[model samples]
Each structure stands twice: as C-alpha cells, then as structure tokens.
Target: MHGPEIVTTLLEMADDGQTRPTPSDAWHLFLSGLRQRFRLPSGRPLAVIAAVLIASIVGGFGAAAGSWAAERTFADLPSQARVEALTRQASPGDDYSYDRSTSAWGTDTTMGALTVSDWDPASARDRFAADGWQVTTVRDMSAGALAYTNDPATGSMTPLPVRGSQFDAVRDGVFLRVTGYVSPGHGTVSVMLWPDDTAAMLPLMLAGAVLGLVAGWMLAAAGAYRMRPLPAGRRRVATVLTGLAVTALALPAFAFYVNMTRVLGPSGSFVNTVHSALNASPYWSYSTPRMLLLLTVTGAVLAGAAWATMGRRGRSTPAADQIPTTG
Candidate 1:
C-alpha cells in the first residue's frame, strides 16, 4: 500500500473503540487485574458487608491492644523510694510513727503517723504547690453518689461541691491525694498517686486500627473467595458460622468499650479517671471463656467446611451447542 493509505489505516485503527483503551477503561482493567490476582470474590454485597463488620471488630481489638500496651510504657505507680522521699522532704520536723506504702490497681499509696506538728492544712497546700503540685480541695463524696442516683425532678446531673480540707493534687501527669488530720502536735497523713499517659496511647491506637483494618479486609477477601464455589446448603452453613464468629468477637470488644466509657465518665475524682485510664482491665474481664468457646467452635466448623469442599469443582458449565450430524 502507499504511505498515505497506510497512515489513514493507522489513524482509523487508533480511533476504533476496541483498538485502544480510554483512561476509565484502563483504570477498570487495572482494578480487575488486582481482583483476580488477589482472588477477591466479586458480585456479593453480603460478603462485602460481612467483611466490613469483621474488619471493624478486628480494628477495635487492635486499638484495645495498642491502648493496653501503651499503658505499660508509663509507670502506673510511683516508686517506693520517691513516695518516702516526698514525705520526708515535706515535713522535716515531724517524726514518723508508722510508714506504710502499697501499690494496687494503678494506684500507689503511702500512709504514716506523725508525732504531732504545728503544720496546718494551708501550710501543706503551700508546700505541695511549691513542689510543682497543682493543689485543690477534694470534692464531696456525696455528689458522686448523687450523680448516679435518679433525680426524680430534674433527671440531670448535679455538679460536685469542692469542699473538704483534704487535698487532691496533680503534677507532671501524675495525680496525688493528700489526706490526714493534723493538730498542734499529732496526726496521720496519707498520700495516693495515679499516673496518666494518654498522649502516647492515642497515636498507638490509630496505628493499630489501620493495621487491623488491612488484616481484616484481606481475611474477608480470602474467605469470600474460598466459598465462591460452595453449594447452596454448605454456603448457608458457612455464612451462619461467619456470622456467629463475628458476633463472638464483637460483643466482648463492645462491652469493654462501654465499660471504659463509664469508668472514664465525669462522676468521681480525677483519681478514678487516672486509675480507669491506666487499668487496662477490660481485656480479660469482658472476654469470658464462653465467648472464646463460641468463637472456637465457629472457627472449627468453618475450617471443616473448607476442608470438606477441597478439590471440588464449581457448578459445571453448560455443554457447548453442536451442529446437526449429517446422515
């Protein structure tokens, strides 16, 4: 052919819809390639939804794990030596009658008796403030009870009253409660400490959530792909098992989160807030043995289904049409 004809033919071929892909077509092809490569099942909205729910549960677990791990990075209770030193430095003239220091449930406490001193509450407050402590009078305990009790008239929470000579102090993200009765020459003193480290926890929890989301998505994709060829009866059973497994995982995490919210709510002292934040108690408390048993059984059944269907072919394709045979 002449060069002009050849050029015209090339232009026509380029313009043909089937000859070249548009940007949208290319994007779709790329996505399709990815789906096939990953063996992701398509055309199943329920499977996708189930995967999303699974991911949410897994992501919650990751966040909880991250928060729990982050708490360990901070000291929940101050050292015994530091507690002793603070008491000695705070009241130099007073001699100790008894010294008892203990740690429990995210709180560190020290109590001792003094053989009488002229030190009053004001002086103690000033001393605490001088030592970088933010001092404030403790709130009335009655107010805390009132917060939970039903208010027949208003049904709204009543604010706590800032009364009492007992002091609550915070310093460097650590909380301290100072309580005692002091007179002209005798008294008992108690100091309790709780630590807070929320700054580091937030970032770790976010990272954990992202990781969990990815893992959950991949797992869901794999499960959907594996069950793509399952018979109707077997598929129904598998779907039930999946639902049971998701419920088993979700309930504990939901219960734990709710409890944490309640514990961290505005009702009690800041001491309670710090304790709840650092306690990390719900992981074990909510994940009971019965829940674990349910999860295990569902998982086992699903695994058995997969094993039983191994090496089986999908629904057979219809035989191709054949031309009529000549006599």
Candidate 2:
C-alpha cells in the first residue's frame, strides 16, 4: 500500500478503537510513565514492584488465617448457663474478677477468678460433680495438670501432659484451676474459657481476604513509590514527608478496614460480640492509645530528619549540578 493509504488505514483503526490497549498494555504504559516521571532505574524499580506484589499476596493470606482463627475461637465459647453454673458454685463470699489476654491471632483467653476463704480442692470437685458437671482430678498435684470435657453424656476427666512452671487446665471450652496460699488461708479458683467454632468464620474470612489483598497492594505500591530515589532537593524532602504522613495514616486505615470486614448477622454474630467485648477491655483501650502515640512520634521524627537532610543536601549541591528536566 502507498504511504498515505497506510497512514489513513491506521488512523481509521485507531478511531474505531480496533487498536485500543488492553488492561495489561495500559498497566505497562502506566509503569513506563512512572519510571520516566521519577527517573527510576529499570532494574531496581522492577525489583521493588515485585517485592510489593509479594508483600500484598502474603498479607492477604495472613489476614485470611487471622480471620478464620478469630471466628473459630469465638464459636468454641461455653454456653452462658455453664459459665453461670460455675460462678454460682463458688463459695458464698467469693470475690470474682475477669482477667484476659490475647497472645496470638485467633487466640483469646479469659480467666475468671474467684477468691474464697476456707478453700477445699475436693469440695470444689464435689460441687462440680453434684451440679452434673464433669470433674477431672490430677493425680500428680505437684505437676498440676488437668483436662476434662463438660459434655454430660461423653465427657470424662483426663490427665494433661505436665509442662513447665505454668499451671494450666484446659478442656473443651473451659479451663479450671484452684491455687491456695498456706499463710493467707485463702484460695483462688480460676476458670479459663476459649469458645471457638470452625464454621463460623467462612464469610468474614472470605471478605477480609479479598479486601486485605486490595488494600495491601495499594499500600505496598504507595510505600514503594515513596522509597523511590529523587533528585536531592525539595522533591526528596516532599517524598519523605509524604511517606511519613502515609505511615501515620495507616493505623486508622487498618482499623477502618477491620471494621468493614467484621462478621455480621446470626451466623457470625458471636464473633462480633466477642470482638466487641475484647475491645472494651482495658488492654485494648490502653494499647490503641499507646500505638497511636508511637506512630505519631515516629512519623514526626522521620519527617524532621528528612527535612534536615534534604536542606543540608540542597545547600551543598550547586544549582548548575541539579538534574535538568527532560522534554
């Protein structure tokens, strides 16, 4: 074909959208534009991009695992009747308090302790048995191990593998322990509970996995961009400051995302209730404030350092040595 005819055909194809770029093509074009705009080296940018992608994928799976565990833990909790029964079995003047701590994802433990006078271990065991509750006695009292199931029909007392200094008794959804001090003439009876059901977390896990992947990818990309090399001047200072700002903002963003992905309705309602209960506890209330304070201080320090470093660099570099803009 003649040159003019060939050109006219290409123009027609373009106008008709026959040659429009695919999503993949557009993504490549966008990356190219970014590389040119930031003067990023080809190899390093690719490596950084890959790292961000990997981080997002890993983060997504982590979120999924966490959500699943949380749901399962929430489902395994004992019935209110069982808790009430145990509490009522305590001595007449027993003082009760709740103690809880979360050590890992999907693992929440609450220990209810009752302090009683004239305590008797055998009496407590008998009390539980009288109430139709399964009672487990540890033969090696020194070792202090206990495991029992509350299932009325099939539950039985069993010996737990004795571990280190920690005194623990866990069975089904409740763990019980009675510790006495010879001098004080008083004993503390503690009931530890972990309620979990495997099926309860499916929907929330699915949603959190999806949303976490998207958010992780976005946050990763922003992080990589912030770390990109810049010509030493106001631009570098600005990038660093922006990064610090983004880092500071991430805490709230994470909290908001968690709230959005929370389980709802009858199916996973227990999980939501458990989360609410935990959040109201002192540990959560204090930890959140401390975390925010740490982030704020860290961000401010980093921003200040970036500003100082950039100002010093700017003063040392001659105007003539500054990078020239490309057309």
**All candidates: TM-score:** 0.51, 0.40
Per-residue CA lDDT of candidate 1, range 1-327, in tens?
123443344444466455655688668757965565345566778877987887776676666566566666655555667776655544544565434432212333344444334345567778889888888964333232211233569987544322224677777776677665443333445565666444565566667667777777776776786677777887777777677667656654454344345434553443221222223233345443355335535654654555354324343332233222348
- By TM-score, the best candidate is 1
lDDT (Cα, tens digit) per residue for candidate 2, span 243-283: 66556635533543343344433532123322232232332
In the predicted model 1, the residue pairs found to clash are 116-185, 116-186
Residue 115 in model 1: lDDT: 38
Alpha carbon lDDT of residue 271, candidate 2?
32
lDDT of 2: 0.47
Q: Which ten residues in a row have the lowest lDDT in candidate 2?
A: 269-278
Per-candidate alpha-carbon RMSD to the true structure: 12.3, 13.9
Q: How many residue pairs clash in each candidate?
A: 2, 10
Question: In candidate 2, which residue ranges exceed 4 Å CA deviation?
Answer: 1-41, 45-65, 72-85, 88-117, 129-135, 139-185, 194-238, 245-289, 292-327
lDDT agreement with native, every candidate: 0.55, 0.47
The deviation in Å at residue 162 for candidate 2 is 19
